[model samples]
Target: MSENVRAKAQETLALVDEVNAMVLSDPKAADAVTPLSQADANLGEEIRSRMDEIDMTDTQSIISFGSGAQTELQEISQAMLADVRNKDVGPAGDSLRSIVSTIRGFSVSELDVRRDRSWWEKLLGRAAPFAKFTAQYEKVQLQIDRVTEDLQKHEYTLLKDIKSLDLLYEKTLDFYDELALYIAAGTEKIKGLDEADIPAKEAEIAAAAEQDQVMKAQELRDLRAARDDLERRVHDLKLTRQVTMQSLPSIRLVQENDKSLVTKINSTLVNTVPLWETQLAQAVTIQRSAEAASAVREANDLTNELLTSNAKNLRDSNKVIRQEMERGVFDIEAVKQANADLIGTINESLQIADEGKAKRAKAEEELQKMEKDLRDTLASAKSRRDGVGDTSGTSVPKA
Candidate 1:
């Protein structure tokens, strides 16, 4: 073969290498992207249903919590406002104003809720919370609904882009292969013509009679240009495929509502809970201290009075002190129980969030495996084609 033919063959092989590299580097991404798209579709539905279910429950919880908080805030507000009117409880009400404002701010907007509860209602049945709890629960449900909708949008866009990248890579590979074949077949044909044993006179006449040499040469050069063009396409595809694959992995859905809701619940519990508990304790301690101080004062008066002449008033005062102590104990028990309920709700939210994270990870791993298998099959086929020479006269040489 002539040096030009050999050079073209090398160029053709280089193109095959470029194409193979583009296809092989991200086979898992190319092949697996299709199923990942479908998975994204399924995941959207699954997540929506789950969010709907969780939101229903969570909204009910939110409503319950919000109602209680609102009640406390309103009561505090009423007392302060009343004090402003009555001029008696004004200082006491003013003292509680900051707490009331904080509680009022904690209340979420009712309009933000998603109230579709057909299947969920049937599943949970009449076991649902009362009106107060339901109202509270619905508040949290709205936040979850917004998050799920955002997740669906994100997933749809990502899966579509990934599938497109996969198709682009496949086409790029095929183009490289076709162009390489064109070069290889052209080279073989030229080699045959060089080896042809024609008479010198016939060869000279044949060469002279062919006025189309320039056109033939032009066509060959065009083919070479085509091969080079395919190589560049394959190279760009490789880079695109890599970037696309990287983008795909992060497309897994994340619920900002899930994170924020859980965080808010925990943080609110952490900060407000201890303060409430301390206030209840302090109230009890102050009342007890006041009673003890009064008792000591009374005993001193009784001792001095007995030294002058009275046990009846002191006995009556002891009975009043016992009643107050019993009331304080009951209030403390109620506060503790409320704290426990809030903690339980926070824990449940965290568990659901963890399950969602795990599902995303599993889906990603399965997709990776699928793409890898496809690339391996393609590579093996190319290797076999390389081993076989073009003994079949139909095979054309590289242009």
Candidate 2:
């Protein structure tokens, strides 16, 4: 199957398993009586005998087992009916009717005999051996049916558990893989601090300043700018380190919690499913025995106990998973918050630098304008002086 489909199936299975566990754990179903204990031993023996005749591996053969047992019960009832008809069976008919009623009570399906009848019909119903025997036979038939249903339900649950376990295991592996990558990335980013070379740059700038060599004014300005840039880079790196340090604890804590959750899931996957299978098999065997009411009660009690225990385990496991998930969410938010703060700081610093650049540009523009005005004024004065000298010369020549 494709990964997505398989994952969806696993998720569905887990959800179903959890819901079933919750339903089974509820105390309300504890009182529902199981009739296997009150069932007749003859009924069980007859059912088993019919089962032996069929090839259980074959669907038709298994189905025949039920039909064959029902037929046999019918024949027994018919013979008793013939006896009742031929001669007066006295209290025997009443006794048979009581047995049939009891069996009817045990039936999962509502038999026709279960409906309300007139007072006369109710009185006559006891006198009919056929009716009583029919009810009794159907009751036994239904027992096998109940057993079959229970078996199927248990088998389906086991399959779902297996699927859920497989999915959890795969997820655990994936989680660790992703966690490793996360850690690696974090480590790499922290190592970026080393690449900043703050100390080396500081030493280089100091050595240049100490040298007696005459440097141009532009060169001096460039060196000072480089120093300022390096200082800003160092400050930013320090902030990054602080954020990383703060987040590391949460990251490690979350990872540890996740690991613990995975371990618990693994433990359940390994142990719980097989345990359920074993218990279900035992319950099925008890159901087939058709012993006294006590046996049925015992079987039900055991089933309930198994269900309750598994449900509790699953609840505990689910709790851990939930806590881990919550912790993960908290950690993510924490990291986001830290990054946001760092981003805000960087934005503020950039804004300040941008303001400084704008101010410097404005000052440079004003200086250039002042220089142009001075040049214009000097030219205008020189032009006026030359005009005066020309005028004086012309006046002297006319005189």
Candidate 3:
């Protein structure tokens, strides 16, 4: 394969390896979950591990596809390079044309001078053999050209396949990243649920009960109950207001003004006991109304606090989700890039294959040259030095 193709393939493989490493994300690796509780942290770790596993699986698949495409491309590039080199195409044509031109030019220039030479010499002087060889090479060159052209076309198709593989790699990487972020976010949410805010609310409820104002309101309940009972009892008595007013001191003074009638009037007062019952009922009604108003006010104040606290909790949780999204920490894009990079790395093997060819060829060439030189040296050395085996020959008796 050409060097460029080999280099690209190598780059792809390296990238794939890098992507795989990222995807592998060491099973033992751990990272912190910020602002998370212990439970959330544990959950996050587990999720991260799972994400890594998924990433590995996904990256492996992407690598496989990419590698396959790369392999094909490398093969194509190699075939093209091989065809270009091995096929006696353009270079052969150039060499043959040069020979034919040289022969024709020489024949034209030496035509008169060749008349004196023998027929055989003149025949040989025209370079007929060179012309024949050039014709033969030109014929073979056509086949080489056809092969090289086909190989070039195949290389073009390989480039398209590589591009497709690259695109696939990028998409997979994006998906991987998205999945990771989503899982991370979900884990966090689960952690939130596990670390439920209800406990705090329960604590608040407990604390609310202990507040002095709340306790005071609770104390007033018994007083209100007592007042209600008293009102009920007073209503059953059915005392008249007019008779109740007669029990007052001002009314009693008028009755006492008749001193001669005072003993009978005083005796009449015993029948006026229902009038005092009426006055007691009025007093109870006024006091109960005041107490009820105070209780209602206290209840409303406490209820408002409960509503406010509950609203705050909902708002806070919503804010957490929003903040997390805004932070971009759980972004899917990173995963996608990683996946794509991994896919590209997979294709690198193809590049490696392409690269290995040139090195192999060069090494083979060097080996052949060394062998030829060694043969020549051996032939020279044998003439000078006797074919002496090593000075010391080990001969061990059978044990």
C-alpha lDDT score of every prediction, in listed order: 0.42, 0.44, 0.42
TM-score of each: 0.22, 0.22, 0.21
Model 2 clash pairs are 37-292, 37-293
Q: What lDDT tens digits, residue by residue, belong to model 3 across residues 1-399?
A: 234433443444443343224321111111222322343666566555433332212334222221222344445446555644654334323433443343333322221221355688577774543343344344543443343333333333333333333433344333333333333443443343335533443444566645564654543453344334333322322122122222233322322232212222222222222233243344444444655776788899999999999899989999998888787655688878988899888788778887899899999999999999888866665554443553322332122
Task: State which candidate has the highest lDDT.
Answer: 2
Query: In candidate 3, which residue ranges exceed 4 Å CA deviation?
Result: 1-128, 197-399
Q: Write the per-residue lDDT of candidate 2 for residues 1-399, one digit (tens) a residue.
A: 124433444444454445334311111121221232343575444333432443323434422322322244345436545643654223322333443454445432222323456688677765333344345545554453343333333334434433433333333333333232222222232233235533444445567654532443444454445444433433443343344344434434433443343333333333433343354344434434533455678899999999999999999999999988877545878899999999999999999999999999999999999998878867665665667576653442211
Error (Å) of candidate 2 at residue 258 is 2.3
Task: Estimate the TM-score for candidate 1.
Answer: 0.22
Local error of candidate 2 at residue 270 (angstroms)? 2.5
Root-mean-square deviation (CA) per prediction: 64.0, 60.9, 65.2
How far off is model 2, as Cα RMSD? Answer: 60.9
Score candidate 2 by TM-score against the native: 0.22
Candidate 2 Cα misplacement greater than 4 A, ranges? 1-215, 291-399
What shift in Å separates residue 200 of candidate 2 from its native position after superposition?
17
